[model samples]
Target: PPGISMAEEARYGFGQPATEADIKAWNIDITPTGEGLPPGRGTVRQGAAVYSNKCAACHGPTGTEGPKDRLVGGHGSLATEHPVKTIGSYWPYATTLYDYIFRAMPFTAPQSLTADEVYSLVAWLLHQNGIIPATMVVDAQTLPNVTMPNRDGFVADPRPDVESRE
Candidate 1:
């Protein structure tokens, strides 16, 4: 303590350690198994309205004509010369989709949507992708069961020799 300069000590003391509540609030990650999913539910019909109001401007009215990343269609195009990687054709888990929409969607305002809104968006997107029926409701219990088209298409990375930076 005596050897360290005041400037160095001041630099280290700049920020306070995060509290448990702070960590909990920031820990909104959702796994592929729907673990850590929040409590809420949404229907395809409800999602359509949320998408129109919050998502259409950047992602297009249909999620395909997107000025941003396309969210639908592109099924079975992975092997083509021009593979159109969309949510329906590419994402492996519906729960992960919910995670993405919940964390970094609407482009302008990230992490602003309610859990119900996120669920609704996922339901509508899955319905648009033909992965789910229009009448299906999406929630923690049901969302994990909705399989993506490319679920079996992805292979585990064979490079165990490579170390993860994380």
Candidate 2:
């Protein structure tokens, strides 16, 4: 800490200074209504190709991994005695799925996919989960339209006693 200069310390204390342009460049937030979704489309079939080329090694061929994270097909298992929560059944919002995968997926390499490639991957995963048809193309227009089965399953946290009473 002695080597740290006053100016450097001041800059650090000021925290990260980000510009609007910088924020715009890195801001990739996608809403549940498809707001901020990029312009692109990908079919389930195309996604299979993309996955094999970009995601298969880490996520496994069928999305069930031997060593890495599993990305698909664990529906109806969450309520069972032994549950394996997956994107198929556990995820409440499809848009969140797309946003998450687009931002951080493939483990080692994150944010390495184009908008179209992300859409393709989403389509593939949704199709694998039986949430969407294989022929469906996931895009900004349609991605938000797909109704997730567990959309209403989660309840808002009611912590009135803990916060108010405490």
Candidate 3:
């Protein structure tokens, strides 16, 4: 320890403990069962407007010509060699779509979309993907029940260490 003169431990103490309100505000996770989905509604018509304003620049007018990840079509193509993994073709749950948009989207600003805006985006995306009709209104309650095409495509892994609950 001749050359190692240890200085006193440095404690920056930069921040205070998060209060309950802070924790609650940040807990915005939405489950597949739609547990944490906020109260908001969006129709396909309204979603079209929202998409044109907020999303078209990146995702394209049709959600297909994306400079980013493609969001529409690609149905029944997952098993093909050139599988176009899109939201309709790959996503298993719609609630997670809401969760994702709420958490990160629009490319320019993450977590900047309001619940209503997120809902509208979800509605537009789903409509483009042919999952829901144009007349359909997507809300927290109906969103969880909108079954994705690939919902049953995923099978549970049978691990030796994990016993089957059934």
Candidate 4:
């Protein structure tokens, strides 16, 4: 209270609200139902090229062989003691994959890939995991429909899930 001032408080009311473009740019969240999906498309074939140029360095030639968290295979290993919870093995919804890549991916630059590029990556990852055909093109409509292997495995927990004070 000694160092605080009323001027600081007044400044809080002086700031301008976020513009429409600014709101849209920051509100890039995609839903499991494929809501909020940007208009774009990417095929597993084109994703192959995108992945090679932008993703392979971290995720390896294929999504599975990468040094980072593997994005392919491990389809039936969830119940095993050593479960590999990859995008295919553990992800519940396909659009969630798109959301993740669009929000944070490529390790080098976050939120850098275009909607189409992210779509391609999702397709290739799904293809590598045998969830979809290699020629499949992931767009808003098809992406939300590509269910993952563990879609029904996760049980919703309705609880007092507020953040702990710790």
Candidate 5:
């Protein structure tokens, strides 16, 4: 925290100044909306094959049998004493799914999947969880529209409660 004033950093920076383009390039964050959904598409059938080849090794063939994380099922278990929070059970949004896969996945390799591959993986996972039909395709338009089962399960964060009502 010491010797890191904003003025000093702006005047004579110890590192190279980043351009607007550079900032955007590094800002790969995708919103809950369809913000970063690239122009790509993938069907459930196609996703099945992709998952078998690329993801099943880690997440299991059905996503529910994974040693890493069980992505499917676990609905209505939140009320139980020992709940199983999973993608089908606890994820709030589908865009978050797309974003996560795009940024970090495969365990062995991150940022390795193309836009299409990411879409396919999301589709497969959603379909395995029964969120979408096997015939359904995931794309920029469809991915954001997917509503997770536990969408309303999370309560709003009650932080900064004393903020001024300006």
Candidate 6:
């Protein structure tokens, strides 16, 4: 081990540069089909409590705001010259909603919510957006089944073309 540094040895000691275990630990993604979703459930009513306690101040009650970004409403604005891109009118993926909420929501306390809380928040937002019924409970099984109105509105990015060259 003469002339071999500890740092060099440590770098070269691994069999694979990165193992599946490492990748899996870091990649905590939930799919649109509810795959990888955690076990929990939240009703719209429960989400209302959660939202008021954790979310409303920043997102505004009922998701409408005088200053902050709106999380709901603005449905059927896709054809307008200036559309208000809210969850109801723009987002195409329900899993993205869950993922975003789980990872970065409640602005003041990011990532502070439980999986159930996240599900509840998603349910409440979707309901406010008019995408889901208010009485429904959002869980691993039900979250994915709530079809978004703009689900098919987005066309695949036909990129590498002239318009996208900028």
Write down the TM-score of every candidate.
0.83, 0.80, 0.82, 0.82, 0.81, 0.80
Q: Give each model's whole-structure lDDT.
A: 0.90, 0.85, 0.88, 0.85, 0.85, 0.83
User: TM-score of model 2 relative to the true fold?
Assistant: 0.80
Write the residue-wise lDDT of candidate 5 on 2-113 in tens digits: 8788988677556778899988766766788888677889888888887899889988888988788888989889899989888888998988988898788887888888
Winner by lDDT:
1
Candidate 3 root-mean-square deviation in Å: 9.1
lDDT of 4 by residue, 45-153 (tens): 8888888998888887877776887888787898899998888889888888888887888777989998889988888888888899977878988988887888998
Best by TM-score: 1
Candidate 6: give the clashing pairs.
Answer: none
Clash counts for all predictions: 0, 0, 0, 1, 0, 0
Q: Mind giving the per-residue lDDT tens digits that candidate 3 earns over 57-166?
A: 99899999988989998888988899998898999998989998878887788789888888888998998899999988889889999999999888888667766796
Candidate 6 lDDT tens digits, 35-152: 8788888878888999888888888888888257888877877799878899888998888888888778777677788988888888888888888898998888888887888889
Local error of candidate 4 at residue 106 (angstroms): 1.0
State each model's C-alpha RMSD to the native.
6.9, 7.1, 9.1, 7.0, 7.2, 5.4
Q: What is the C-alpha lDDT profile of model 1 across 1-166, one tens digit per residue?
A: 6797877876856677899999889998899888989899999999999999999988899999989888899988999998989889999888888888888887789999999999999999999999999999899999998878998888877876777796
For model 4, which pairs clash? Answer: 59-66
